[model samples]
Target: MFNWKRSSVIISASVFLLTACGGGGSSSSDTNNNPTPDAELTAQQQALTDIANAVIPVLQNSNNQALSLANAIDAYCDEVAISSANVASTLATAQSTWQAAMTAWQQAEVMNFGPSFDGGNNSIRERIYSWPAKSSCFVDGALVDYDDDTAGFDINSQTPRRIGLDALEYLLYSNDLDHTCSTDSSTTSPTNGAWNIRTDADRSLARCEYAKIVANDVAAQITALLDDWQGAGDNYFQQLSTAGSTSSRYSSATEALNEISDALFYLDTEVKDMKIAEPAGISADCASTSCPETVESTYANQSLANIKANLQGFLAVLNNGMDDLLEDAGQGNIASTMTTDINAAIANIDNFGTTLVASVTGINEADCTNSTSDNRLEEACALHADVKKVTDVLKTDFVTALTLAIPQSAEGDND
Candidate 1:
């Protein structure tokens, strides 16, 4: 069911560069006086064809590790039935990555497009286009759900972020449609860049818009699964109080909780991998190879490394936030009764959130362009932390609030 969307993730990446509603963008990187260029969307389609050809061979090839990942996803799906609470957690992961990527891309895309300029995504695209190796954690889908006025997906819908990622994929891999400027021999050409800095800023703004949706709509979809976990937890306790007797019901609840954790991991992985990987895995820091003057020590000493590590530690906190998931699902043991795994996980993440905000708040924006590898890394790290803040809310803080409203079940059932 998700194949169509997944396949398209790398295909639709071209259109995001365009401005709709029949308006032309200036900031034209081209020197041409022409008001409009030939429709180059076709060139974008061709780019997708090229990426498909390149990636498909690998998909069909004989490889152990690559094949193993496919097998694992299959096994995970079978355990949770395609429609249970497990799907909630499954969507959660994708939702988080999508939220982060959109923020990053938009932060990069947020510039205004003026007339007389092609104003393509030159500033950000060029830097990332030739990059090799993708960091799966950085992949993100750009589609907006629920809160978005652009595309309003139903609360129960599970289209996945593949389509959104596809849009970005096309942009990254597609061949250039306007190399006319490159061939021109003018030494003082203003349109020599692939895309403009304004466009990059727009990309980042669009991302922020998408993050708002994940925070609201995506969270709603996961509520039911969380409800199931809490219900099952309560039921397990009630039964034990009546008698130390054990039953198969608790095991079923255990399975449901496990499924929830696994599903979240899967969806998040899907969104995170597809986009982040495309730009060649993101680094800790690099500011156009120009390390800042103040950063005189080790490469890792740059604020970017600290930012990257903290952001990574924050992601670690989210993954680790669910460590207590299975604990409450198990058979009634003494340790189980005394602990609220979900609560503890939430607390840990909340604590980390505070630290991230502190590290990010004080850094100067000028440090973003230093000569050291750490400068760029630091910029990405700080930006990453911003995304992480939103993620913490969607994945942890929001979940914590639900415990207050959801009535813990006194009896457990799979439904």
Candidate 2:
């Protein structure tokens, strides 16, 4: 499982934008219907409520988008089975919807708690998109098993390595029927005699069928996640919003706040280090000075978009509720600085006209070291620096100001 560190929080500062009520008769400005609560709640309450209201809908959108992707896969599979001329267009539509679902999902990536982290394994979250745990060979084997209707071959029982968005990416985007496995004894090898003998049309049809199975599972996971948030029995929204209450899961409002802040570190470890530094050849993970192969969504070339979506999720938490908390703690200047720094990071990504993989490759390492502005490598490095600015404070003054602890997973690493 990927290190699920980053978390999202939203507490709209709009809560402070209430209509005035003075000793005078009602002015026309009194038209604002919803006023501030008569009894003031702590910042944690407001933040949790706002996050539940804002992010649950994003999760729902992802689920809806997954349904569309599944439908497209079904149509494409049918067309391929009959060798229809519309195969090309149908395949394009399936890829497009998959991209849409991914964008929404990336935006919700910061909400790394509650149902998504059920059983502390991130089972539901990984089922939707298991990155860093990706395995093309396993997906290839599972495809053969699913196509052959091999005994005990069930999509539900398969691990994250063999299904979800990453698996679907391999199926839909890869034209190579050749299996990625190295051994002849592997499931997709000649000895197995299942995958290698298939014609191009048969391979295409089989891949589509397997992709549809994964898509349905992804969609079902999304539904279960949303239900976990809003359902009457296991409602996380109520538990978070009513922190410290008799029936609430959290014993104190600060405890809930700390959980939300822990998630903000996603920018530090995942986006800054894994997404940018390693691919840009700045991290030890890359064998060379630059490794374009390390970039995410390589098949679809959507890595840049994924980073942008991550920043969007981070900003949703920072701007929505954390800003007000900062003001309440007399650290409003830090809030302003964090927002400005995060926006600068987003602006850096926005300037790139190409995918992250393209930006990371074909660069003179010397020019990047000198901070050349015209090349892709320099821009990618700048993005890492920009995000690091927010995270530097996140691990230091931000936590001090909010009285929140850095998550145990995030401790003891200079990078």
Candidate 3:
């Protein structure tokens, strides 16, 4: 999901104190001679604990869904390998399961701190869902190499670019043997050309085996992440919730808040810039009115779904985690406004066609580059603008009120 060190740049902390800290209403005890007040539990501290509590269940559910996705992928691969009679149904089921996993993953994206961060040289996040830098050539090469010597081809040995969600997407949505390694792309090296001459059955079986291997690897990684969070004793969740304690990673509740707040910038950068603007050709990299090839999930036609999932994830962070904090800060109205704006943005996308390619193609054919007329492109643009409004509030009002740090990559990126 996150490229870790590559995309992230270190930025100095910018903390703002906008409003006075508001106190939460305390409950009175019925029968107590002299009950000691929980004076140490401040509003900020409660808010941090609330966020941690809200997040734990979501993460556990996400882990279960990841396992389910792995099972589905493995089952689909097995059917494909044996040329089963129910291959079509199995593939469809696998696609559905993948979407479910993607939804859960998106929800967890806002919490992409702490355990999700890279440890030393290991990248658990990329091992699960490497995008933008995905290399289909690596997948193609792996398939070809597997065909040559199945015993020598190990999917786990492949780099992060070749064997995550994107690789699985390539294998599941695209036809068998469709990917090819070429010399033109610098992201991946060209492999042996032997696969080009292989029989259809051979290529399909090879791809299926590779997909199975990737699924197993993904499952193991996801389970490890889950275990780190709440599977047993000495979990990260306890450290996160018990901030300021000697055992906690964070020395203060604000540090925990900053981590979650910074993670929300994924919506501002990746969702807004890469997913929406890049494909719309509004990004700096594109000159045309639209670039369908840059769109994520182009093969599956699930770009809109991805956007919806992202917004939903953002909403989850606000409602489940940040609402109480905003209320304590006497800025509950901001949360209400954000909820309304985000829901409206989602509805705008729903009004537009879900298939991004089809919508963009229609806009291109009409040559409605600058037209203000009520058309698909205009609708899409309106949705983009609406989402930008939400982002603006998040970066400015939300972060400033919460005194949260903006991610370095997202800093100064007004787009």
Candidate 4:
């Protein structure tokens, strides 16, 4: 989720204006027909504009991938309805499509501003791919409801927990028909006990049907999100590139640049803490040392894949124009250093050589420490440390150099 508050006081516009003028921005002249060829968008302005450009294709590709997933799910459900012998094969195709969609959306995760953050309480992104706040229990209950009252229940009207990629994962991956909720939970009680009475094939069919509905809903939401960014709705790309103009939502180009920088912080908390730390047992959330169940895409076992996609998104923003901005500000070393660290983290993740769950399991049982001789655990911990190196600069010097504020979620975080 996004933090409404910014930790540091935003730098005044006057200072930013001075910084921009001193930097390598183009200045129009009546006397000279040709301005200096070196003159161009300031690093800050360029960063802002670059993201606006990048987001369009990111959203478009994500929407296309989602549509593919929906089509695949439709075929899978069709097979299920007829008890086709090719049910498993069709289901595999759907799962593969889901993974592709997930990869595309994961890249879009870093481009989390404008339509993705504005009205409806981030419902658009949530509808497409809710995670870290999802509930299998709610999905289970919704499954029963969708199965029992097919005509009455609408997946489009469901909450994020009940209908998203996470729910689809449960439907497509988990073979278990048992409710995830406890007996005390309404989902597991007599009112919804019909879930358990069904045969395995019946449960599979119901889950597939539910998955098809959820996939369609996800595809619709992705289209809506894409339209919001495109000219069809807000034309956020223009608003972002033309920031500081009356038409743009941003009061200044600096504010627009800050928005993109703030989006990058998602790598710190979500990528570093929630995705890696909690699952690896280093973060406070995992008191037992390792909680593999909390890993993103637990059912699909795409945790490592998700992290890799997150890095790709992170680099998408950092490489866009932030590095040039740093260089113009004489902070090029910061850019080089953090880029190296980010690449190191990626290398560690790539070299881990196995699933995240398997790596966590390899940790020393006695101490729950990542220092074990097990190369997998060491490599996982190395990845965490590598990421922290990049984020450490993000929270301090990067924000200081750019005059951007630290997100409230990272305000007091020392690690």
For model 2, name the residue pairs that clash: 6-263, 7-263, 11-320, 11-321
**Candidate of highest lDDT:** 2
- Tens digit of per-residue lDDT, candidate 1, span 1-415: 0111122323331112111111111121122322132212222222222222222212122122112322333333342343455534543343334333333322121111111012233211222211122221122222222223345444223233312222233222223322112322321223222222224333333333343333333233223212322234543223211121243332322232222223233112222222211111222233333223222111112222222322332222222222122122221221122122322323343444333223333444455333122223343343433333333343443334212111122112111
In model 4, the runs with Cα more than 4 Å from the true position are 1-43, 120-122, 184-193, 365-377
Number of clashes in every candidate structure? Answer: 71, 4, 0, 1
For model 2, residues 241-296, the per-residue Cα lDDT tens digits are 78766435788767777777877787787888899888988788888989999898
lDDT of 2: 0.73
Each model's TM-score, in the order given? 0.21, 0.86, 0.82, 0.85
Q: Highest TM-score among the candidates is held by which one?
A: 2
Give model 2's TM-score versus the native structure. Answer: 0.86
Per-residue error for 329 in candidate 2, Å, reads: 0.3
- Cα lDDT computed for each candidate against the true fold: 0.27, 0.73, 0.67, 0.71
Worst 10 residues of 2 by lDDT: 17-26
The TM-score ranking, best first, is: 2, 4, 3, 1
Q: Name the lDDT value of residue 379 in candidate 1.
A: 35
Relative to the true structure, candidate 1 has a C-alpha RMSD (angstroms) of 26.5
Per-residue alpha-carbon lDDT of model 4 for 1-415, expressed as tens digits?
Answer: 1111112222111200000001122212112323232333333345566555545666777878889999999998899999999999998999899998888888888777778876544478777777878988889888778877789887667888898888888888886877788752445434435566667777788788888888888889888887777644457766776676544588787788877777888889898888888887888888886777778878888887788777767766665567656665557678777766766666777777888887777566434454432333355565677777888899999989766899888788886
Candidate 4 yields a Cα-based lDDT of 0.71
